[model samples]
Target: MEHPARTLTARLLASRSLPRTDPQVRRALVDEAFRAELEARLAAVGLQLIDNPYAEHVAVALADDVHEPVFGAGREYAASNIGLTRDQIALLVIIWALIVLPKRERQVNRQKLIDDGQHDMFGQEAPLPHGEEVAGSLSEASLLADFAPVLGHKTYVQGKLLSRLAQLGFIERRGGLIFEGPLLDVLLDYRLLADRIIHGTLGEVLAQAGHPLPDSDGADEGL
Candidate 1:
């Protein structure tokens, strides 16, 4: 008979080498013996190996010692609050740029004129004030351009993504323009959560564009 240690090692090696597409391999991957060993090993490092076959990918997280009630529900509620898919988050960031950048530019110009003591350019003693309404509308063309780097090459996919976001109440499309919806208000209410979600969703884009992400300091960087 093979040595007990050698037998366990062989089983682990065989399980790791198995292809996930094969039924037998899938079963072996989640075998009770293998999971027991995995859990024991993970526990040594204060982690847990949860089996979530329904998830598209595995997730790693810090283990919590507290067993408080309603904790799971609270987590679910937070997820629901920021329920936009990854693609939708990316699209929303682009829309925000289109809506905010122009207003920011105008505000800078108005401040400059006021500093120069030339505030009567429009026959008024004060400069025209910038308002939120002016920065909340975006044309379809601009949005398409903003989305080009990520989703532009695939027009069908882009259209579907935009339609999905609209259907989810994240954006409103009217004529050839898009406007912020109630969902955006919810995101803004939780600014930190929104930032973290955007950071994770746009990580690849930021890397490709040679942009740096803000430093993480005990913030949720998405799942």
Candidate 2:
């Protein structure tokens, strides 16, 4: 009989990303033995599971241990494995900060409320908030106005980078709004990126534009 771990691993590679609610994905999340087997299989090829409780999708990435061997052969390892230019990376960070930081805060709050409501000491814990349920869309026009100067002007951002980001599964654009895509939260490290965005110069720019980072003291770490 074919092992389920192999099947699930193949599915993940084929799909690039899958929702946490997917049957195979949910099984991988809850079944520790199964997950370990899956991880072992992935690590054979120098890959690792990219799973985050706060994010909606699960994906795979090159393992950190093998990163130097893989990406450092011919060129100085750049910020991304994909061929993203510096400006594109900057624009991606801006959009991620605008959308994900607030969404995570809401998810944490909702989970807290659920925990408070459950009186049974042994009650099964509620699932983490789904991205679509807590995430807010960014107005493309507003983003263009606020970040055009730094992001290479409105025409360039609108003409090139947004389309590329959308193609790369980082965002989805519809009706003049941008929604988080499958990889937005999966590929990026939230704890690393959030701290930098919330405390760094970008925080000042966002605040000036009336979209300040939400206040939180250690709540971010809880998630």
Candidate 3:
């Protein structure tokens, strides 16, 4: 059988992302030496691991030093290599905010509860929640009703834009509901984007939709 660390690396390269529940992924999450080995191997090729304790998946991305040379070779820097339009990017952000922000808050709260020694005796050492336990799905109809005006091109938002996001593993759509895909949390840095979305122009837009976010100050440090 292949070595576990090598297999993990190969899987990440091939699949782009893997759920935390995968055996290799679980090993990487809890085994420091194994994780370091994996990280070093990836870093050799100018890639870095993208892992967050609160996120349900792990992925790899270009190291910062490689970003400019790789994407900005000739033309102006592109927002995404996949060729998403400005509006498409905007819609992506909106969906991310609607789904991930609240999910993060729940994860943070659960962590706090665990830290406060509030867990049941039998579950005292339970791991942090992942997947749908910490994340929640959104209603497609509710999304259209709430964000269509802000996003415009309702047909495109409901069709091509959504399909594109799904293809890229940012979201999953099924039977009029939307769920977070593997890359949704791992791809975006919550620490950096959360504060901006909570306090900036997007915060105002979200407020208009009757979904005002909590003040960033309310979250625990490093959250």
Give me the candidate number with maximum TM-score. 2
Candidate numbers, best TM-score first, in rank order: 2, 3, 1
> Would you estimate the TM-scores of all the predictions?
0.37, 0.92, 0.91
**lDDT digits (tens) for residues 133-218 of candidate 3:** 77788898888888877677679788778888999999999989999998888888887888899889999988988887766665
Candidate 1: Cα lDDT at 156 = 47
**lDDT for each residue of candidate 2 in 123-204, tens digit (9 for 90 to 100):** 3366777756798899999999988887788999988899999998999999999999999998998877787778889888
lDDT score for candidate 1 against the true structure: 0.47
Q: Which portions of model 2 miss their true places by more than 4 Å?
A: 73-75, 118-124
Candidate 3: RMSD over Cα atoms?
2.0
Could you give the C-alpha RMSD of every candidate to the true structure, in order shown? 21.3, 2.1, 2.0
| Least well predicted 10-residue stretch by lDDT in candidate 3 | 214-223
lDDT of 2 at 62: 89
Clashing pairs in 1: none
Best by lDDT: 2
